[model samples]
Target: MTEGVEQLYFHRARGLTVTGSAATAIAARDGRVLAAAAEVGAGRLVVVGGGELSALPFLGRADNARFLLNTLSWLLTGQYAPAGSELAKAVTHERCFTVRSFHPEEDLAKVEGSHVVDARPYRSLLERIGGGILPDPYQEQAAFLLEAELRFDEMPRVIREAVTTFRHRSNDYEGLLVRGLPVDAELPGTPADPARRLDKSTWLSELWLAGFASALGFPLAYHQEKHGLLFQNVAPTPHNAANLSSESSAILLDFHTETAFHPHMPDFLMLHCLRSDHDGIAKTIMASVRMALPHVSLADRCELFLPQFRTGVDYSFGSANGVQGNGPTLPVLYGNPYDPYMTFDLDLMVGETPHAQQALEALRSAVNKVQRWVRLEPGDLLIVNNRRAVHARSEFSARFDGRDRWLQRVCLVSDPVPSAADRRGSGRVVETVFAV
Candidate 1:
């Protein structure tokens, strides 16, 4: 093993030198010397060379590869090691159902008694808008007038109540299926059938605007043209159908934090399940690094803080997305002293330092420790704290039976951010997924 290591090191060194690049190489007798050859940038490129690479045993080679990569990463990014900082001492979990449900009767009473327009009606109004029906023109105008007179403060109160109730228990994900929001009783705006059109103005007036804004405050941010809501449909395309039928098994998607490439990433992501897997096999997996932190070693934590890592894009979005490549290594955790943030992607991140490799392994182990699997059903909504957790999905078959899995995903950036201005300036709502 020793002989092979020596030979391999020499071979890599020679490769670097032969390419006329200045690099660090260890001689058999002289030990280690840093040599400078400039091609791409200023620095001694370290090269480990040898045909003995093939002879190196699996474990040894793995270590060597990790070490070399981490080193290179550090050289390129000029960042420090990971600190494995602890973020929240304890996260609060609240279930949505436990919160005060939006009640129209109660709200109506308040408005009648106090001369205020009840916002609860707005929830029903949104349902009508989303249902794609035209409401009575006069009723719609009146509903809008009522909504305009209603106090905006009440809207936030309702949203806060809902959010406070739905924060997850122990885990980082939270969920709530908001029901009873009035849907438009009316059918399509233009219809051959008149019966489809019903009185939907009230539903649209109260529910739609409130729901959209509420989503912005708690889990969804209204980041115009930058990042906000995402709409996806399970169309009957051959590719989608093929994905449904062939990938039904629990296929492991490498763990990743969403949109690491983007400058502004979502703090939370909500996926509303409109349909479930036909075979009931697909499960979404989430791993909290905070939960995994205790398992990491102190030394590994230091390495992780080092700026020797690079993140490639994830695969959901194709390659032509114009994302930054081979950027500097960012620490896995950072933020307030008490509440640290996280950035990680096992598949897209490359560590180029020995310490960074150690940190990566430690983080990997920690993530595995707290991994949670959730299988979603129709109407089941999952809200993930994107900054605090990494998530992936287990592949499931989609039988092409029109009953294939379907989900509605929306990304949100929470409080203390510039949301209203961003949304007003840009019409872009959906967050872009990076390609790996």
Candidate 2:
């Protein structure tokens, strides 16, 4: 074991001349000094030749594990030994390996009151303004939705309850689904491909989306994705089916916290279905941490709290994405252990330690054990609390026969006024300004 460690990590660093060598190499390989000691003013520096020796993968090597502790002890204590003397491993307690136990604060509660709404007055109001309400510039359309909300002077009891349930207890409910929205009679067929240009006229149910988002909070947009469009089209496009994009990707589309890597991700994401797939199996699935936490063992919970995982930025964030290091190391769960904030991605987050890998697997197992399922149809709007739940879509075949499934998607934040202050000009899209 000692010979292997010496050969692997301490090779090729022997010959550098040191006038003030406080420590010297005793187990070097290949005619070089692997370990050496030097001084800088009042401080001491222990230099290891092969930087890769410190990586996580090499930490399990017997001497490799002891090298760190011994080096730190000698440097901090200012201890010195003769040129040919080697530093051996020190004594340590055993409790470091056992995890402290803890319990999650909340249980995974299924979101209810999500599929109820009254369609009469809403449809009547739109019918009164003809079958269309296309306004120039997106801001005007948003403004019109705000003003038109007055049409429902007395919101239907059920719709009022549904909207109210979403605002005050959204974090608890996870999301709300409103059904029976007014769909246009003469609807355009499914888009054949991704938009070649930005076009708001193609919005399936603009007035409803804007009004719904306004009632909850103002809608938000990102400069990095969908060309900064405040509201984007979600449909099965041949171009994106193989990718992970929520807009048009139809392959299984794994569950993920929307923009888990973004510092200023939306607080809510709204999706209203304009058409369903020819087959009815493309159900939208959501998993809430509230429900999954109860199943996590205490040891896994402790491991999950350590910042040993890195999540990669989603592709939609655009070029230079790869250059950016995987986002800062952070725990899968943060904040109150009972009701913590969760940010994860099966495709992106990588664990750096054994405990982290164990925690990731435990969390994934818990999430996979339970889920909320919804099948979208015309006039159905799904409002997901972007903070508490991870969402995904079931795979469905897209024939591209102009009958593909179509939905309108939008990103929304609770308080747009503050975000607006940071936003440049009057544009709806907020670019990189704040850094977390």
Candidate 3:
């Protein structure tokens, strides 16, 4: 009975025993009557053999969603419902299922004019915060983070407001760039050793990273990654230059949501640059589902919402993190349908079915068409909404002489209650043993 619907999915469906002449078999699977319809007075009744069609998860698969909507419209109006019409899209369960409209181009344009903050006026305040010798950021993180939070009000108003707005408003742009921030005049060369990079006297850029990240949410560290350091280093290492990680320079790092396979993923990821690549061409690219959704077809969008894909754990998290194989099957897109959030890892995510595979390719092409690039400088900081965006790095030449591009990275989450069990004794670091 669904208009313009050529296919419908059925799981363990039974035959509808049609006895009356008024009953009509509109859909059938093999020789079984999967669906039937009957007209009564000014209304109609539709019987579906598959009871699971009412469930949201089942409705999103194949053409079942459209069939349900069109059937509902026909029953209410006693006429053939035209496909892609407003009448065919109405549902009686709107109260339980809700969605808001989102225009990515318009929302992105509104934030583009105010993404960068003039940091020259805040140099004195930044110097005061990072000038003193403080507790080690990694070893004594509690004390160090408290020190940064205490000075949150002293930060620039533009940045403070921007961070607050970006945190609360989910439809805003995916990335924020802060330029002219203060950094250490004489910095050590980019060290390959993760621990050796943390042995620094001055803060400056690190302070900026902490202040902004703390203002947005709680800064997090993974026990299995980077020795659980609050501020992890992102620089090319000779051993990992050909690998698929932030330390790789020989290969293009594919786009991914930070820690997509983890249960308690970060809400925000901040990258503060301390140095630039030798050629200054290694660009960081980011793409949002909001920007790419407009380019995708309705059929592909429906397929993407189904739980037909799996994401693998990053090698950086190590293989002993309790997660095995491809972790769990999950949908690439979730949350509000119009303004949704997505988790995608180009190198680690795979579609489980043929339809999902085609949809995944559609998403990949859309993201590639709308991707934006940013070349970070020595005094620049890029804060990304990790849930709404996926980020990647371009391939660049790296010299082993310790002058390669260096960036300090940190993650934040709006709410920590969901991950409370994973954290050890109220610490910022999440224990890898309990991560699944």
Top model number, TM-score: 3
Kindly indicate the candidate among 1 and 2 with the higher lDDT. Answer: 2
**Would you list the C-alpha lDDT of every candidate in the order shown?**
0.45, 0.64, 0.76
TM-score attained by model 3: 0.77
Please, what are the lDDT tens digits per residue for candidate 2 over residues 1-436?
Answer: 2231343443223354444456555445556556666666788776676654543323333355455545565678664322211432221111122223222222222223343344656666545543445553265755555544553334456666677777777644376777667776667778775442234443337666776776777677787666677667677877677777765445777767887777667878899988899887688887777766656654466567778887767767762323233665677777764467777676667789876887787778777765666788898888887777888888888888878888878788887776776567865677863232
The residue-by-residue lDDT of candidate 3 on 82-119, one tens digit each, is 65434323332121232333333422323445555666
TM-score of model 1 vs. true structure:
0.50
lDDT of 1 by residue, 1-436 (tens): 1211222222233232333334323333254432222234544343344433322211122233333333444556543122201110011111101212222231111222211223344664333334443333234543432343343334445544554454432233222333233333432232121112233343342333334334444333332321232332221234423221112233456567776655566776665554567777677677665555555543454355556777765333443222334444577766641245678887667677766776787688777756665576553445566777887777666455545665545455666244434443433343333334
Error of 1 at 194 (Å): 31
Candidate 3 local lDDT, residue 253: 91
Candidate number that wins on TM-score, 2 or 3: 3
TM, every model: 0.50, 0.66, 0.77
In candidate 2, clashing pairs total: 9
Descending-lDDT candidate ranking = 3, 2, 1
The pairs that clash in candidate 3 are none
Show model 1 residue runs off by greater than 4 Å: 1-162, 165-229, 234-250, 320-328, 415-424, 429-436
